[model samples]
Target: MLHVNARGMKCPWPALRAARAMREADAILIEADDPIAPSELEALAQQQGWDFAALDACRFSLRRAA
Candidate 1:
């Protein structure tokens, strides 16, 4: 699994990093301390038609559609 370390990042940064990682991996685990991280990533996943699961309030896993 690809890992995107977005912990402590500000708004948009976590989403940007996750998007970049998606280019190279079908699945990715992202860790972000930002309170908005989950929602932002949920939006991204919807836009991309992917699957999104929150491992925690600050962590998420995104997977591309098969």
Candidate 2:
């Protein structure tokens, strides 16, 4: 699993980083403080046919659909 720290990061940064890593890995754990992080990431995961789950208020996990 890949780990990405997008905490305190702005929009697109987190999503872009995650998208970059997704090219190499099927699963990733993202940590972000951005309120929209979850929703944005969730949309990306869905678009990629991956699974998205909330780990906490500022943490989430994404994995290839299984």
Candidate 3:
């Protein structure tokens, strides 16, 4: 799995990076503390048809829908 550390990144950036990374990997783990990252990521996953899982308050994972 690709690990994306967006802990300090702001909104859109974390989601952007995760979207970009998705092209190269089937699964990705993201650590984003931005207040809006969760919503953005969830939207992205929905739009892309990926499985979204919130590992914790600041950690999330995305996997290809199967």
Candidate 4:
């Protein structure tokens, strides 16, 4: 598992960082206090065909398919 704290990070940075980390992980857990992070990450996961679940309003988990 990989954990990322993107609480104050904005836009593509969070998503980009998450994507990069996910590339080397089987699963990724991310936390972002910013409102845009959830949706942006969701879209990125969808576009990449990764499995995702929102743990709460500001937390999300994603898993790469093998």
Top candidate when judged by TM-score against the true structure: 3
Q: Report the C-alpha lDDT of model 1 over 1-66, residue by residue, as the tens digit.
A: 998899889989999999999999999999999988899999999999999999988889999988
lDDT for position 42 in model 3: 97
Reference-based TM-score of each model: 0.96, 0.92, 0.97, 0.90
Off by over 4 Å in 1: none
- For 1-66, candidate 4 gives per-residue lDDT tens digits of 899998888887888889989879989999887778888988999999998889998889989866
Which pairs, if any, clash in model 1?
none
Compose the digit string of candidate 3's lDDT tens values, residues 1-66: 999999999999999999999999999999999989999999999999999999999999999998
lDDT of 2 by residue, 1-66 (tens): 999999889887888888998899989998988887888999998898889999999888989887
Score residue 39 of candidate 2 by CA lDDT. Answer: 85
Model 2 lowest lDDT segment of ten: 10-19
Q: Candidate 3: where is the Cα deviation over 4 Å?
A: none
Off by over 4 Å in 4: none
The window of 10 residues in a row where model 3 has the poorest summed lDDT is 57-66
Q: Candidate 4, which ten residues in sequence have the lowest lDDT sum?
A: 6-15
Q: Tell how far residue 21 is off in model 4, in angstroms.
A: 0.4
lDDT for 25 in candidate 2 is 91
Ordering by lDDT: 3, 1, 2, 4
Query: Model 2 has how many clashing residue pairs?
Result: 0
